[model samples]
Target: MSKKPIKRLAFENLTIEFGDKKIVDNCSFEFPLNRKIRMLFNNDVNKYAVLHAFTQVEGITQGKYFFNEDDVTQFSFEEFMSYRLNMGIGFSTRGLLHNRSLQENLLLPLMYHKMMSMDEALEHLKKFYEYFDISSVKDRRPAEVGPNMQKATLLIRAFIHEPEIVFLDNPEMLLSKGLYANLLQLIDDQVEKGNLKHLFFSTEDEDLSDCIADGFIIVKKNKFEFVENKKQMRLAV
Candidate 1:
């Protein structure tokens, strides 16, 4: 059987500090991805890790980072934008425009990617609504929707553009056990369609790591190290 060609996106030796204090010291690892399964996950090793990864505002007095196998020893604005475009990122704290209807939020990513026309965008949105089991409430405002609904909608928005990789920081933050299967299915669809790649970050639940993940890398001392696992993951669990 033929398999989708997988390429290394980026892995890094992470070393970061906060105001003369060290956090993420020497973290190194690879983001394993492929056609059949490509979801790179990143769970915060420390409370401030997410802030450091996203904003790089403080912390990380020293450490190296990488994307698509390239070393990012230092962060730059232009490079960051370009990198984000090629890849996708989703975080719990990342705000959504709750003022708009669910349908509108779903359409934003498509618009950003300069994808199909209005009609096309609508059609795509409809598909996403169906996939997320929210077709009936497409016109509802985010405030009127359930938390799961909001999360599913935003997730669809992130992947609509089929980014090289989609980062879900702590996917289980609000996701329930019942939703885990559904979540994996949603991610599986993109891989099956050869549409997008994924990177999921989690801490408490290791099962989630093996669910929609092809492989996993652990972060420590600003370096990535892989743990060997012989267990198999089911498509439907």
Candidate 2:
């Protein structure tokens, strides 16, 4: 028997389109494992489309998405579900269920995946709520909480299960200075503990990106360009 090659999280000859427009044209890049990557885009629409495609929240026009040697684009329902179990994604907006309480929203993934019991999930979430200072709004529905609280919940939910790869779309939006600092700290802690092996985030804040990202992925002219050095990333920007 031959051992399968490890591709990790990667996109090969990927193309994404919106209607008649090609957002990403035959882009191929393997996301480096155990590193924080900042995704840069020329425009919001392109950013949205590419990010959605990366997370499989939207369909790709063409190409393959590989995760640990498996083609995610070819995954069946069961396969996709299994693939998603190793991923944690935080959307910029409308990520939570409107009818569900904040606590419920954060707890669903952990419980549904059967990663832990209800008690264990809640107990696990307690620290996050405290750290993000959203404990008071836990029982409130998404509509009832402020944007910061809602965003905090979504961010917490992403890492709640300690998935191998985390995709955060515009993670800094609607967060306070203190809360944002706390978020960075949380990420540092997670990485240090070896719980989060890969993190890809799109943020409009260049300073934040420069401060945290180990590398840069620039999405422009329907292509994905990788920059491993901070100086090169700045020049690319």
Output the number of the TM-score-best candidate: 2
The local lDDT score (0 to 100) that residue 233 gets in candidate 2 is 77
Model 1 C-alpha lDDT per residue in residues 1-237, reported as the tens digit of each score: 112223654434456665555556655555555532322233434544633463332354444555544444465655455555555555554456878887887787667657668899988777666666888888899889777777776677667666656666666655557777776777778767866655544434667765655554545434454543424222211
Candidate 2: the clashing residue pairs are: none
Q: Write the per-residue lDDT of candidate 2 for residues 1-237, one digit (tens) a residue.
A: 112223387888888887788887887887777789988787634777777787773557688888777787877767577667767899887789999999999888787768889888889999888779888889999999889998999899888887778889888898876787888988987888777878899987776776679988887855677889878977987
Off by over 4 Å in 1: 1-6, 10-13, 18-21, 35-44, 47-64, 69-76, 221-223, 230-237
What is candidate 1's TM-score against the reference?
A: 0.72
Deviation of model 1 at 213, angstroms:
3.6
Q: What's the lDDT for residue 205 in model 2?
A: 76
For this target, which candidate reaches the highest lDDT against the unseen true structure? 2
Cα RMSD for candidates in order: 6.2, 3.3
How well does candidate 1 match the true structure, expressed as C-alpha RMSD? 6.2
TM-scores of the candidates are 0.72, 0.91
Off by over 4 Å in 2: 1-7
